[model samples]
Target: MRVETVQLKGYTTLGVGGPAELWTVETPEDLKEAAQAPYRVLGNGSNLLVSDQGVPERVIKLGGVFTAWDLNLTPRNGAYITGWIGAGAMLPLLVQEAARKGLSGLEGLLGIPATVGGAVRMNAGTRYGEIADALEVVEVFHDGQLRHYRPEELGFAYRTSHLPPGGIVTRVRFRLTPSTPKAVREKMALVDQARKGQPKKKSAGCAFKNPPGDSAGRLIDVHGLKGLREGQAMVSLEHGNFIVNLGGATARDVWRLVQRIRSVIPLELEWEVWGVIE
Candidate 1:
């Protein structure tokens, strides 16, 4: 284990945040040991936004053994394959691997920046599909014990899951079907093409979840909130649901923009924002 004051900005995809007491665990045993105490587990940091004041909680980042994955074809069921992926395994890499193996289910997640564990926890997805669609089981460590859980037990819905409190997902098993490589590639191509409208900048994916039957992006856009700015943060012109950090944005800058949007929209239908804000 390597311990240090790691800058949260470098860890997150948004490229903005203060420092945190960080520990990089290379083995499962170390990870479990670190979890024995109160700590936040970080994956690719794709869906997170830490405060500019820095996090006080100890942060544990998985590595080495935790990034390994195993793939096997089911016996007598040549059309089906099972993948056991570690929590730290990158989602985009996994999608590419699935395509290379002629797998079909994960092609829709081609461009998402997340880990298997994070994706499962958030039920991450795009219009094509959600991670819950292919997930079979999740292995997690919580309260000093490691356990396996099925999707139903997790209560997956929308962009959330009922994960155990302070639980650290260690691995995930996905059930996928066999398909032609060309078909899988084509599906991935479509997914990539659809993402063209998303800003290619520092952002924590979507800033909020859609409200009921309405899309958050549509609401924000229709209300003329796109391009709205606060300090260095601005609502993405390309996608209303995204808040991009322009060069030296702070957490407060993003929060200010969020508040501005909330002021105009009804509270009952307000977008649910994520991230740690002080």
Candidate 2:
């Protein structure tokens, strides 16, 4: 295990945050040991925004054994396949491997920078599909015990899951259909192309969940909030729902911009913002 006191900005995709006690665990044993105490589990940090004052609890990052995944093709009726993936595995890598094996399921998550655990916990998805759509079983460690859970048990919904508090997902099982590699690649390319309008800078993906059938980006854009700036953080001109960090932006800057949007937007819209602002 590697231990250090480091700035959270280095760990998050947003590139802004304060310092915290960080622990990198290489084995399941180490993870369990660390979990015995109150700690925050961080994955790829794609959808998180830590506070400027920094996190007070210990931060645990999975590595080594947690990243190892095995692909088992179990044939049933000779028409479909079942895949089991490690929770710590990267979503993009899993998509690539599935495509290579002529399997079709996770194409919609092509550009999302998240691990399986985080994706499943958030029911991460786009207009194409969600992780829960293909998820069959989730193996997680909770209260010092390892258990398997069905999708229904998770209460999956828009950008949220009812995973037991303090639970750590260790593996995921997906049900995929047989497909031609060409077709799989085409789907992935289509999703990639669709995301061209999204900002490519340092951002915590979408800043808020779309309200019902309405799009959050469209609402923010219509309100003329795009390109709005607070210190070094600015609402992305390309996508209104995203707030990008410009060089030395601090977490406070992003929080203030979010507050501005929330206060100015109509109250009936009922949109929920993502990230931890502290």
Model 1 regions lying over 4 Å from their true place: 75-79, 266-278
User: Model 2: how far is 22 from its true place, Å?
Assistant: 1.6
- lDDT value for model 1: 0.82
User: Where's the lowest-lDDT run of ten residues in candidate 2?
Assistant: 266-275
Per-residue lDDT, model 1, residue 224, is 98
lDDT of 1 by residue, 99-119 (tens): 898887987677889988888
Q: lDDT at 141 for candidate 1? A: 84
- Per residue, candidate 2 scores C-alpha lDDT tens digits across 128-157 of 999999887898888988889989999999
Clashing pairs in 1: none
lDDT values, one for every candidate? 0.82, 0.83
